[model samples]
Target: MKFVQPIRDKRKIEAMKKVLKSESVRDYALFVLGINSGLRISDLLALSVDDVTTETGNIKERITLKENKTGKTKDFPIGTSAHKALKEYLDTSSLETTSPLFLSRKGTKAIRREQAYRILNNAARTVGIKDKIGTHTLRKTFAYHAYKSGYDLSMIQKLLNHSAPSVTLRYIGITQEEMDDVYLTLNL
Candidate 1:
């Protein structure tokens, strides 16, 4: 399969927030968590309410997850934005420790992977993101933005739990144009 590249525009994020329903703060959390935490969709979707939130509605320091594909234990730190989003979502959602972090409209136990894609894609459309944003978009967005923030590829690889830097770079879809521009503006 040809690997798809995620849309990396910051404005798209703003547009997504604008289109999201006020009551569906869970959607907001999903987007924020994916982009900020760099957690895979499976791991993110697998989270229960208690995994990330305290009973008092505060975010925990770290979330421990057993990655499905790799069979490794990974810990994700909670950031301010993700914490805030979680708090807001919890206030409106009836989720419990046994409930999935995301749920279906019927209040079912789980949200299918396809539903996750739609939540992201619909929001991306509101923000004018033209690419085919899918389940993996948020993961790629997190890595790309982290790289732009001056994090090293090796560190990113480790954080992503990738076996190699090349895999991590490819996962984030770093283009040849971006690579070529690195030395174009060098000073004496």
Candidate 2:
């Protein structure tokens, strides 16, 4: 498989949101929830309306699911950005509780992995993101930003369920230049 990079620029992320929201709220919600929750595309797509919303149709404070690859139960709190986007989409959508959160236009099933890839890849290109982008970009973007925001490498590794900090660092695409800056800036 080809390696994909994170959307490193906040401006580009915002641009992607704006463009995607203009086109489809479902797509926008997908992007917002993907980056904020750091879920694999399979887990993200597998979500049902009931997974994110209460029986009364309120957004849930957190989401819990089984990871497709690791077969482990994962849970995380939903951030404000993800909540807002979900509220907007669910309010407008008429899907049932058991229906797929990101439904396909041609059927009731969740959108296929290839469709998710195209949706994100097209948005990245529209935002002038030159890096390789795919469904994995959303997960990597979350890891990258969480690291940049001063979260410890160990914490990020745990979040991504990776085996080692070095794997998390490389998976998030941290560069030699960034590592060098850490040495230069911490001069003591």
Backbone clashes under 3 angstroms, per model: 0, 0
Worst 10 residues of 1 by lDDT: 1-10
List residue ranges in candidate 1 displaced over 4 A.
21-23, 55-57
Error of 2 at 188 (Å): 2.2
Quote each prediction's TM-score: 0.92, 0.98
Candidate 1's displacement at residue 128, Å, is: 1.1
Number of clashing pairs, model 1?
0
Which candidate leads in lDDT?
2
- lDDT string for model 2 (1-188, tens) is 68999999999999999999999999999999999999999999999999999989999999999999999999999999999999999999999999999999999899999999999989889989999999999999999999999999999999999999999999999999989998999989
Which parts of model 2 are misplaced by more than 4 Å? none
What are the candidates' C-alpha RMSDs? 1.8, 0.8
Which pairs clash in the backbone of model 1? Answer: none
